[model samples]
Target: MTVLTGEMLIGFSAVRGQAGEQRAFDPATNAEIPAPVFGLGDEAEVERAATLATKAFDAYRTLPLARRAAFLEAIASKLLEIGDALIARAHEETGLPRARLQGELGRTVGQLRLFANEVREGHFLRATIDSALPERTPLPRADLRLMKLPLGPVAVFGASNFPLAFSVAGGDTASALAAGAPVIVKAHGAHLGTSELAGRAIQLAAQETGMPDGTFSLLFGAGRKIGEALVAHPAIKAVGFTGSRQGGLALVRVANARPEPIPVYAEMSSINPVFMLPDALRNRAEAIGRDFADSLTLGAGQFCTNPGLVLAIDGPELQRFLIAASLALVAKQPQTMLTQGIHAAWQDGTRALDALEGVQKIAQGEPVKAQCNAAQAALYVTDAKRFLADGALQDEVFGPASVLVRAKDFSELLEIAERFEGQLTATLQLDSADHDDARALLTVLERKAGRILVNGFPTGVEVSHAMVHGGPFPSTSNAMYTSVGSTAIDRFLRPVCYQDLPDALQHDALKRGNPLALWRRVDGVPLQA
Candidate 1:
């Protein structure tokens, strides 16, 4: 990967706005990577982008769905074409393996294709037209049509853990572009180089497809001030974010505190718990323990859906299996986390876990050093009764840490599942012989998470059309929308109701010509009315 020079980083105005200057640094070597950082947008630039988006939305929103879909497909092709180089830069910066970067690149392209397909189909418009009744005994029904319209400008905050899939060219930006909403992305400082590379690719695609020049913007910086200024700016109509609960909540407060609070879809982290039944514990106790340890430490436990908590029915069999499984996790070489802030946060999480009363440490990891990487590992076991009584125990630790809860009986196991906050996914370890009891527990977990698995881990999120990513609050601010599948575009749109208007005045979507031919419900029949 070529190192970006200070001169190359000089500010350039792509949209009508003026982006501010911010310095760039290399996270891997902790040295200055470039000078005169030109991409980082300030409050003034944000205002200018919003103005241009509002001006452009008048024409962009009326474009046929097929045309919009074609633009998205072009972006997808560009992403696939440059997949290898992007993955290499990602590995150089984050210290991740080639396979992981390749997988994430696939997911990013898959999301773009999924959104394009969704736009082409046009069901997301959710058009509903109520036929008019000119004459009735007492009342007359008026024609009313409803279809989703793009919010003017959206502010997207990138995540550190997923630089490619959640950064400049990630799901949020792709979905918003497909929805006809112009986007301004706040890039994470941890992966600025990766963001710049992908950002250039997107610009090339936009130019090739004849998209509006100011439609997409990428900004990078180290402090919270830039983000706060962007969110609080009046031009920003909506916000999309993925990070810690505290960071998400702070953005939420900013949006809500505004004159006109916009919707903030913040996917905060969670302790996606896996419940292991006693019967399964008796049968594959050793196997389950090993799998749990592997899943807990996968990617150094940087995933938001990492299984940080484990709930199992208490018994001698369960205890014996967990002890053997945890001890088997030999102290491996420490790996670099996403950023220094993440590393510090991991230590804070470990401190919180250690401070919990009655928590027994089954294992401990070596401390990370100044120059070399370090892996701090530990296993804390506690009683289910204590877990339920202390609400503080449910907080996510954000690393390769696991808390095993020993429930006294089957009833206590069910109670623990019910008490869990919203999560991305929940896993169940069950024995085939105990199908009846497992079903009971599975049913309880279904309501608590977006995806429920049987005898599997929740760490690997498949980027498929059938995937439902967002869950209840704390997991995500919106449960009805997902951030990983074709459905993610819905978050960038808002429903617009149309009343009495001639064909000339009506939007193309509602015009008699039915130019887009999108599916619509007219007089209780599914048709393009």
Candidate 2:
């Protein structure tokens, strides 16, 4: 087992950063871990990592596909080998329950193996060949072959809410590596120790698998300084980030200002909305209300897809829902949040909402005298007139706080849905008879959200091939890409065309007789050898 140290992993070497330092905190205990004071990085360290990655880009990207797949598998094995130590550090640093961290660890490893399979599958390369047309009617066409190639070094910003699955060896790292790009991660401040543990696992995996020395690196620092510097580094071709909308937009601005601008795939804010159609609310207001409370409180509502807004008709059913939700919410105890800053932000947002003219405070959980940096679950109500009139109503509270909006009728409900900013998810609690209402909402939701649900909440996001964990503008900087699943590899790749290139000069995938036996399009027709 590796000892906890405050050093950053800069390729094969572990160098202690010379910049200012900080320690991890146990939010649950309201105290610091008192060990392994983490050293923050600055432009100097970013220069070293980015330079090494530039030196290693070709060597890492041109490795045989099978060897690349094996490298990913090795990373998964190394994470598993770390075992309970990783989960324990994550729990202490983030104040997350051990069981939840255990599951997250599994997800972290699972995504690495998933990207491994993706590398072997080879569809992401998008190999295509248009054979030479020597006997065309008027003009002959030259042979053209195209395939996707990895961009250079990528910068990844670790997410605070998901220390394991979206941090050190998380989706961004796994997907970029699968696309054959070198990675540089900026560790989240809240989980420095946990990030170091996972970073060590990746560092060891790279060495053990004969990967290039600078194929991966992890650094720690303030986002404004080290993070923006990393993005502005000429060697970095793209970036992956998950955090506040302000932070994401800041990185985007830096990336665009560079001499050679780069893409930033950032998953930011979202206030996932839930619509209870007339029939569904009438049939099961109590059930929907209880489930809504549970989803709002899950993981302290730290999830990006947390249900922040609820919409329904203002009627007896809506009244029934308020009563049932109030009963469930008020009985729940306050839960420890991730950090002091986040807890304070949630407090500010809730207070501001309560101060709004027409927003009614329906329910609030038990007082938070027992836990440090804890948040009480809360539910509020307002009419569509007030909700649509105030843009502040759309602001994300970032905790277990939600507001319900009562519309006059279905038209007003649709109007409320259309008024939403970009969101990660929009959910519908509908039964068979409510399909027509759901149908009308689906068309608008398709344009408004990345994912839609039927009769379910958005708290649980499945990590699968079909999942789209991204959205437009406020939800993510780039709506075309997903930060999760197999397709995420596309974010770090670009296509290149070879004009009448001889087989001897081509890679195996583009060689004659399909040397690698991968599926390729020849003469515009897909074929497998």
TM-score of 2: 0.99
Shift of residue 281 alpha carbon in model 1, Å: 2.0
Indicate the worst ten consecutive residues by lDDT in candidate 1: 3-12
Residue-by-residue lDDT tens digits, candidate 1, 348-398: 878887888978777755455663233466678999888999887898888
Clashing pairs in 2: none
Runs of candidate 1 with Cα error greater than 4 angstroms are 1-40, 364-373
| Predicted structure 2: clash tally | 0
How far off is residue 170 in model 2, in Å? 0.7
**Given candidate 2, what's the lDDT at residue 99?**
95
Q: In model 1, what lDDT does residue 499 have?
A: 79
lDDT of 2 at 60: 97
TM-score per candidate: 0.91, 0.99
State the RMSD for candidate 1.
Answer: 3.0
Error of 1 at 11 (Å): 12
